[model samples]
Target: MITDPQGTILALFLAFCRMGGCVMMLPGFGSGRLPPQIRLFAAVAISMGVLPVLWDLIYPKASAPGATYIALIFTETLIGIVYGLIARLYTLGMQFAGTILAMSIGFTAPGGHDVVEDATENALTNLLTLTGLLLLFMMDFHHVVLRALVESYAATPVGAVIDSQKMLITLTDTLRASTMIMLRLASPFLIYGLMFNVAIGLVNKLAPQIPIFFISTPFLIMGGLFLMYLSIAALVRQYADGFAPIFTSF
Candidate 1:
């Protein structure tokens, strides 16, 4: 066992701590409403699983523990956090799209549920986020994420120079891209919502007594839900397609 060697176990534990921390904050696994204990267990399990395979290539020398070792561990942890953030940013696209769609359809409620972390997001936002998460798992995106984590060790080694500037640039670019993609995803709903509201407004103006707003509510909800159902497969496909280019970019 790697731990059998003196000081090796300590280094390995430090490595696992970094890996586990990152996983504890990763997109799918970290986002859900799971117990903290379970999440920690998962992180430990994953780190232990990967350590053996990756130890030789990524393991830093365990000799002469000092400031250099501490610095290297810190750097390694930062690298893991960066990798984790990439996936998290990608997952945030759904939240952005949901927010857009919610606002467009008059579902923008400040009922605390309109946010995922603090409380709850809007119903539409929650739906979108959950749907996106489901799609991620269904499409095996987590598998891709693990592969990327392994690949990251190759791309950015332990104790090596971490291009912080490059990491910042990459994160900013990814965030911008994610925003654009979210807008694109919600574009159809935006257009539809806009056009529908405009037409409804005109109808209300022409026939002031018709209660057009009341009548249209059912239609809008039904149509919106149906459209979501119809486009779900395409949406998932787009997400899957978008996910692939990111690993290579890093």
Candidate 2:
């Protein structure tokens, strides 16, 4: 059963190269808050678990003489990074949308500790990002990603030629799709802010002597907060729903 210990170990490492690349860039797994040891172990475990299913595909390639094996390592790692970035870009897009929403509604609170990342984020943005991530986890989005990883072997085999153009196109398409979705989600607040500001401007023009700027600040923040409160549920719901279609499309 263990006749080919060397080959098996090599194959497992090759698998790890790919899976680890993905985990290195994958959102939750790669988050700065999670320990490196945990991510490393998770990648190793996933590679080992999937090895049997992919043995036929990986074992032979892992046997390549020195130069080829090294090349295969790079190729596999790049492919995995591409797959991970597809999902990463989508989440980053949501964060972008959140920032826009925050600005539109006048929630300019100072950046604080991010719930997910080690960096700073506005309170409103942090709320949106955390809530959206929680919803995605509750709906099992990671399962979808894991399924995609398994299916990717067929789409991109162990030693296949890495197509830079195709990968670039895939990333470009993901961004385009994600941008459109985020823009759609954030548009309502954008419009609301524009209209509110325009009306306020007109009022200012009519009553130039009044301290309109100071007076309108409170109203702007209050209105934005109220609107966000009313729509937060729907916003996060739509964000979680959009992930599958965008990810699966490419």
Candidate 3:
């Protein structure tokens, strides 16, 4: 029953290399809040679960001697990173939109520790990013990603040479798509800010004696918050919906 233990261990390690690489940069699972130990074990567990299904595809390749096996280690890790980044880039778009939203709405409060990342971010930006990420978790985004990873073996079998050009193209495409979606989500606030500022500028010109800029600050913040309250649910819902098509297509 324990014959070829070395071969079996090699196969498992090969599987872990890919799974671990993917988990290393995955969105919710890869967040700074999660301990590295937890991520490591999760990747190992997932690799174990997937190994049986992929044994035929991986065992022969892993058991090979010499430099070819070493090459596979690098290629598999690179492929996993490419796949993980596809989802990671999309999630990062929420942060991008949040920053723009905060700036446009004049909600640039003092920075606070971000719940997702170590960096300091505006309160409104943090709120938006946290809400979006939480919604993605609630929607079980990781399940979708795991399913994609399982399916990926068929598209990219073990031992195949990694194509750096294709990986670059895929990454670029994901960036373009995510940027477009984020901009669309943030466009309303942009327009609102532009119109509000233009009106304020005219008011300042018309009534030069008044400190209109200072007086309008409260109104700008209030209006932006009110607008966000009215539309945030829809905005987040749309953002979540956009994720599926991207992941599925990728």
* Candidate number of the best lDDT: 2
With candidate 2 superimposed using the best TM-score fit, by how many Å does residue 46's alpha carbon deviate from the native? 0.7
Model 1 clash pairs are 113-120, 113-121, 114-120, 114-121, 114-122, 115-120, 115-121
Residue ranges of candidate 3 with Cα displaced over 4 Å: none
Give the whole-model CA lDDT for all candidates, comma-separated: 0.74, 0.90, 0.89
lDDT of 2 at 143: 81
- For model 2, how does the per-residue alpha-carbon lDDT over 1-250 read when each residue is reduced to its tens digit? 8877888888999999889888888888889999999999999999999999999999998765588888888888898898889988998887899899989988898899988889999998888898988888899887888788889899988888888999999999999999999999999899999999999999999989999978998999999889988998888999999999988887
lDDT for model 3, please: 0.89
TM-score of each: 0.85, 0.98, 0.97
Q: Give the Cα error of residue 199 in candidate 1, in Å.
A: 1.9
Ranking by lDDT: 2, 3, 1
For model 3, how does the per-residue alpha-carbon lDDT over 1-250 read when each residue is reduced to its tens digit? 9578888999999999889889998987888889989999999999999999988999998776579888888888887888889989998998899889988888878898989987888888888888988898899988888888888888888887677788898899999999999999999999999999999999999999999978988898899899999999999999999888998887
> Against the hidden true structure, what lDDT does model 1 obtain?
0.74
TM-score sort, best first: 2, 3, 1
TM-score of 2: 0.98
> Tens digit of lDDT per residue, candidate 1, span 117-219?
5466677777777777777778787777778777777778666798989999988988988888888888988997899889999989999999887898877
